[model samples]
Target chain A: GPKVLQIPSHQIIDMGQMVTLNCDPVSNHLYFYWYKQILGQQMEFLVNFYNGKVMEKSKLFKDQFSVERPDGSYFTLKIQPTALEDSAVYFCASRSGTNTGQLYFGEGSKLTVL
Target chain B: QQQVRQSPQSLTVWEGETAILNCSYENSAFDYFPWYQQFPGEGPALLIAIRSVSDKKEDGRFTIFFNKREKKLSLHITDSQPGDSATYFCAASGIASSSFSKLVFGQGTSLSVVP
Candidate 1:
């Protein structure tokens, strides 16, 4: 099975500071996604990126959030001036094609805003 | 509105027992449904899936029973084991004009298979 890798398995930062979570998707995967999960909650869709563009985003994707994959590098979620509500485990996922519902996800990055 | 719903926020089953987790969806356009399994530290992994065209899908000890008319699905784990204890999520997605689409996930059902 292909694996997605997330950097900084755990991060703690002050509220109002910038934070960037990195996701290294499978080598050949094209469609990338970010999901957020608070403690004991459902995994909520944040955004999906493909071909260097944001294809779809949910309301959970706040105005301060942005995503980009420069030069086919790591797909990153950057939050400028984080809020306490932004604290959650961020999981990055990718799939081979659009027709299938299967997704491969990384271990997840735990972001803590204090 | 919440597109997907799951039942039994927490379940406990003895080893070798059969565990059934229930799920239902509100979306009519969704054609594909997948179940994902997650542990404490790991990410959710694809466990199994059933399409609206089929009533059932089985893989090893895991089975998905779907009802298109009811828009409901269930994941049955046969001969449950302690190793099988985890949070299971039911997700649904529609077929887009493109090759892939996003998934709407239900609140997971936490299962504990006590040995």
Candidate 2:
């Protein structure tokens, strides 16, 4: 099983501060995705990125959220001015473009806003 | 409007007993269904998957039975073990059928298997 690494397994930040969660997707994977999961809630799709551009994003993806995979480096989700509601476990996933979008996910980064 | 819904938000089973997790969907266009297993401090791993083309899929002790007509599906873990105690999620996607597809997850079922 391939592994997707997420930096900063747990992060506690003050509300209104900027936070960047990094995901190292599986090697050779093309389609990258981010999902948010509130405690005791379903995992919600946030956005998907490919070819250095965003393919589609859900309504949960706010204007303050952005993603980029710079030159095959780590795929990052940067939230400007984080809000209290933004506190959740963010999971990153990736799949091969040639495959059926069977996603592989990272452990997740838990964000706590105070 | 939760497109994908899971039932029995929590369940407890004894070792060697079978566990049944149910899920249903609203979208008829969806043709792909997958199950994910998650443990504490770990990511959700792909457990098993079934497509609209098939009514059932099996892998080891895990089985997925899908009903296309009713748009319902279920995961049955046979002879479950204590290690099988974890949260299970049922996810659907039109990824294979449509170009614009995203994986949508169910609320999740937390299972506790006692030894």
Best by DockQ: 1
* DockQ, all models: 0.77, 0.72
Give the lowest summed-lDDT range of ten residues in model 1 chain A: A94-103
**Worst lDDT window (10 residues) for model 2 chain A?**
A94-103
Candidate 1: clashing pairs of residues: A98-B99, A98-B100, A99-B99, A99-B100
Q: What TM-score, over all chains together, does every model reach?
A: 0.98, 0.97
The 0-to-1 C-alpha lDDT of every candidate, in the order given, reads 0.93, 0.93
Docking class of 1: medium
lDDT of 2 by residue, A1-114 (tens): 889999989999999999999999999988899999998479899999988999999999999999998889999999999999999999999988675858999999999999
Per-candidate total of colliding backbone pairs? 4, 0
DockQ for candidate 2, C-alpha atoms: 0.72
Predicted candidate 1 versus true structure: per-residue lDDT over B1-115, tens digit per residue: 8899999899999999999999999988888899999999899999998888899999999999999999999999999999999999999998543454789899999999999
Docking class of 2: medium
Alpha-carbon runs more than 4 Å astray in model 1: B96-100
